[model samples]
Target: MNEIELTIEQSKIYNGVICPYCKGISEMIKSKEIYGKDYGWLYICKPCDAYVGCHKNSKRPLGRLANKNLRKLKNEAHRYFDKIWKLKILDRTKAYNWLSEQLNIPFDYTHIGMFSEKTCRTVVEISKRALNDNRRLDMDFGVEPVTEFFETI
Candidate 1:
């Protein structure tokens, strides 16, 4: 495990955040509450918690997708969203192709004869994660985090 220590000076100096869990630079996150709260804000782990405010770091690397690859995936997702706005079952072909290109994970899309349903579900979840990551990228690029957008969603 990487020894992640909070730089108190840095934390105090800036109004930003450091994760209480791993002490990594915390990224602001939003969560949808079911009861009365409905939605709220929090700081979270950048690498692991794509959007759900999950802090536990996974072995998986963040944005392992190249900037170019991520852009392509994001654009394709927008197109997919245009075709079908439902968040549940996104198109498998687009999702797999983009993920394969982004992660450089060699996969035979056509040869995926057996686990089609499982693959579609997995890709849908990954697509949501990728979309969340895209928002973070927008933030990094100086696009404002629209709190209203989070509240309404």
Candidate 2:
């Protein structure tokens, strides 16, 4: 019907993946194209300017290309999720495993980097709830809260 729909149909027929916003095939290019400094390569949808960084030392994309809004959501999700392990309530692997269980996805596929915007929002919500629950439990059980203890140099 629309130009975007037509492109999406064509993209599906091809081997390459389509951009979520513009329905265009993404291109792999150096990050310098966008950032003016070579951070690394990225899979990018040029028209939409949506992009995902590659894995270290490889061209493989870290996740689906994300626009500004999705990127913001992903950052928010990470901020909340990181606290679970940062507080030492759980180790990194265990924290991801816990998130996997909560999200009802396979542990191997449960990375926040690969999450959709809706899933990212879910992560933020769930992590906040878990943090609150942990605080309540700590209060009830008289457990001391763990926080950074700084000593004067």
Candidate 3:
């Protein structure tokens, strides 16, 4: 590509980012602008009123910029889904793989950050059901995890 074309492409992905909600260009700024204290960096779209955080020490977005409701859904999804691994029903990686299989999505696209609101709700439902069932688990105190039976949920 020519220099001008390359520059345009770079602008599209650089510190001035894109708002997934509005498709408008977002600007990278310190987290203090939104949070009242410097937590890290974020890409904010003022007109659309959306933002997303960057990876630690990097400008790459953790996920798409979304509205408030979607952010709340993501948090709720994490609350339910985290128990599968946090309770040692499966290790973190295997828990993710189980969720991927349940959703019929590749592992790469199965993150809560990447999920639609519907998908987040599904994760919450599935995770809650899986944990509550405990069909594969023995009566032990969350010590003996039967990873194979996560499929039953």
Candidate lDDT scores, in order, read 0.39, 0.75, 0.74
Clashing pairs in 2: none
What is the C-alpha lDDT profile of model 3 across 31-140, one tens digit per residue? 99999988789888888877777788887777767678878998988987898898787899999999998998777766787677889889988987888666444535
Candidate 3 scores a C-alpha RMSD against the true structure in Å of 7.1
Q: Of models 1 and 3, which has the larger lDDT?
A: 3
- Write candidate 2's Cα lDDT for 1-153 as tens digits: 112233555433232255767877888788898889997888878788788887788776666678888889999999888999998878999999899889987776677767789999999888887777777677678987553221211
10 residues in a row with least lDDT, candidate 3: 1-10
Error of 2 at 109 (Å): 1.5
Local error of candidate 2 at residue 133 (angstroms)? 1.8
How badly does each model clash, as a count of residue pairs? 0, 0, 0
Spell out the clash pairs found in candidate 3.
none
In angstroms, give how far residue 13 of model 3 lies from its true place: 9.8
Q: What TM-score does each of the candidates earn?
A: 0.27, 0.76, 0.76
Clashes of 3: 0
Candidate 2 accuracy as TM-score = 0.76
Candidate order by lDDT, decreasing, is: 2, 3, 1
